[model samples]
Target: MLNNIGLPGLLLIAVVVLVLFGRGKISSLMGEVGKGITAFKKGVSDGSKDDEDEDKTLADGTAARDVTPEAETDQKKV
Candidate 1:
């Protein structure tokens, strides 16, 4: 039953939708859709970068941590 829609039928449906919602509303809706797709892509890329950083470790087989003031002073005295 769904296969019965020909090009003319699709065009009529599109025309009716356009009439119901003006051109500006449809255009803004499409713009929001585009922004959402872009944000999703960016989030996926950032997540992969974080995973890669976590995989890195020091030569002692322990995970790396941020340097503290005490650790820095001890290293300097040594």
Candidate 2:
């Protein structure tokens, strides 16, 4: 039923919203949205750097490190 809101209808809606919440309130809300987007981008780049640091392999073409416990190695001797 909402497929018929043409240009005039949209303008009426915008006028009603402006009357209800003035101009200053809307501008401040948009400024907060811009800050949120910048912070999200920075967080994603930092996480990628941390992941790369943990994945470095040895220069001689071996695994990064051995994770086996000492007890597990002794059990293999039996």
Winning model by lDDT = 1
lDDT of each: 0.91, 0.87
Which segments of model 1 are wrong by more than 4 Å? 58-78
lDDT per residue for candidate 1 within 24-69, as digits (tens), equals 9999999999999999999999999977877786667699886679
| Over 4 Å off, model 2 | 57-78
> Pick by TM-score: which candidate is best?
1
Give the range where candidate 1 is weakest over 10 consecutive residues by summed lDDT: 52-61
TM-scores of all candidate predictions against the true structure: 0.65, 0.60
Clashes of 1: 0
